[model samples]
Target: MKLQQLLSFTRKAVDEYQMIETGDKIAVGISGGKDSLTLLYALSGLRRFYPKPFELTAVTVDLGYEKFHTEKIDALCRELGVPYHVIKTDIAHILFEERKESNPCSLCAKMRKGALNEAVKKLGYNKVAYAHHKDDIVETMILSLIFEGRFHSFSPKSYLDRMGLTVIRPMMFVNEADVIGFQRKYDLPVEKSRCPVDGLTKRQYAKELIHQLELDHPGAKQRMFTAILNGRIEGWPVRLTREEVKSSS
Candidate 1:
């Protein structure tokens, strides 16, 4: 997708969920990947003319990997005129060398988010923007169902009361395919992940499963996303009509 298309989808999610407010400072969690970089581009574009004025900062928690560098990301942030911060941590060593975890994605994610949240708080940002998109939402719901025997997916907006932080996924309406297209079209500086278990996780399985389902049954992904929107899942934002959105804006 182009930048304009990305902004439209992002603004839709933000408006529907009321994610941003006047004078709100949001930290975009940058992982140097396509999804995160696409989010940075979307929010940077949205910040220019969205009715509600807000501030944005790009943040990444470096997991102490030798090959994982942020030079390109820093340059991109500079190009976008957003402040960039990298929190250095020994999470890589802890997960791979010391613990040798067979299934490290869960622990790695927790450690990464814990570090990211703390940095965001210290940076005085009240909200954090995650890059989870439509595919991620459906895949997560499928993962929950197949693994935990439940039908659940994360809300577009969630409050972490204990940490005093609000997490918002602004690209909830953007598809993963569109993200890839945006990255390629814009020449996004994507830093490849060096993690050993990058694509061997259950989430990867769910993603592939969804891809196959979509191939067999056209529009399956859209149906699942629609179901999630209408399922009345706990913490989901109430759907707003086009009239309501116009009046509110």
Candidate 2:
């Protein structure tokens, strides 16, 4: 997708959820992947004239991988004029070598998020922008249903009272396919994930299942997204119409 198209979709999500506020400093969690890189670009561009006057800081938590490199990402952040910080941790070794746990994704994710959150808090950021897109939202709900026998997904805007921080997903309206297109078109410095279970995870299974269902039932993805939006799931913010936002502000 083009830059304008990406920003438009991102702004739709932001405005609907009131994700960004005046004088807010947002830390963009850059995982060096396409979704995050796309988010970085989207937020950087949004900060140009978003009217709310928020700041952007790019952060990456390096998971002590042997071959995980982020030189290109560092350059991209410099080019965008966003302050970048990398939190170095031995998470990879802790999960794989020290603990040797069979299911390491859970622990690894917790550690990664913990590190990211603490780093953002120390940097004086009030909110953190995650790159969870529309596809991620539906896939997470599906994963919860099939695995945990529940209907749940992450919210667009969630406040972590414990950390005194807010999590905002500005890319919640952008599709993963569009993110891939944007990365390719813009030549985003996308980096490969060095995780051991990168593709062999429960989430990947849910993603494939969703893809198959979409194939069997065309427009199924769109309908599923609509269901999620209207399902009244807890913490999922209600999307306001343009007129509603205009009048409210």
* Candidate 2 lDDT over residue span 98-210, tens digit each: 99978889889899999999999999999999999999999999988888898888999999999999999999889899999999999999889998889998989988999
Model 2 residue-pair collision total:
0
- Per-candidate Cα lDDT values, in order, are 0.95, 0.92
Give the TM-score (vs. native) of candidate 2: 0.98
- Candidate 1 residue-wise lDDT at 126: 99
In candidate 1, the residue pairs with backbone N, CA or C atoms under 3 Å apart (3 or more residues apart, or in different chains) clash, namely none
| Residue-pair clashes per candidate | 0, 0
lDDT of 1 by residue, 111-186 (tens): 9999999999999999999999999999999999999998899999999998999999999999999999999999
